[model samples]
Target: MTLKKPDPSTLDLSDVDWQVSTFESGGGGNCIRFGRKGEWILISDSHNPDGPPLVFTKKELEAAILGAKDGQFDHLAGLG
Candidate 1:
């Protein structure tokens, strides 16, 4: 099957509110995902663009986001 590319518009990824993130396929270290519903996402806060992006199940990600909204989860991200 052909892999479907993510549409930026549909994802609504952007730098604002310091919450909700989506992973970018680039960077070396310091990758973290943070934020709330409607503002959900993943991202890599690094340089070099070598490290692989982290992965999270839709359910797990949604759970984490809920945890974040309630101030329960930390923002340290990693690949799964």
Candidate 2:
């Protein structure tokens, strides 16, 4: 089944239940927040909650999470 992408401009972010990762405790304001609304997964900077969030489909978010777990993006963080 194919999921339709949501229009970010039409999304009301106020309704999203944003959450920070537990592993980010005491990270000194450096972290990302994630939330979900309908069929979209939302990601935004924790330091700027009022800023626009990046939206993704379930599968897309899953792939990103898997990649992170595999350290595919470690280079971007200077870890690889």
Candidate 3:
């Protein structure tokens, strides 16, 4: 069965439980924070907890995680 992507716009982000990766703690650097609401995954900068976030479907988030594990997005780090 195909899963429908949930609309982040319809979500109440305030009610979601946001979490930071364990690697982010005491790393002396800012990193991304993520939260999940149903099938949607929301991402935001840890430094800006109140800032706007980018939302993605669970499948899309999974794909991104896999890509990161494989170093497929290593080049992005240099773009900063």
Model 3, residue 17: distance off in Å is 1.1
Per-model root-mean-square deviation over C-alphas: 9.7, 2.1, 3.5
Q: How well does each candidate superpose onto the true structure, as a TM-score? A: 0.36, 0.82, 0.71
Task: Give the per-residue Cα lDDT of candidate 2 at 33.
Answer: 89
- lDDT of every model, 2 decimals: 0.44, 0.86, 0.79
Candidate 2 TM-score to native: 0.82
- For residues 1-80, could you state the per-residue lDDT of candidate 2 as single tens digits? 77677767788887889988878546686689899998889998898887888889888999999999999999997899
User: Which one is best on TM-score?
Assistant: 2
The lDDT of model 2 is: 0.86
RMSD of 3: 3.5
Across residues 1-80, which tens digit of lDDT does each residue of candidate 3 receive?
A: 86765555666787888887777455665788889877678998888877778888778889999998888888887632
Ranking by TM-score: 2, 3, 1
Ten residues in a row with the worst lDDT in model 2? Answer: 21-30
Off by over 4 Å in 2: 1-4
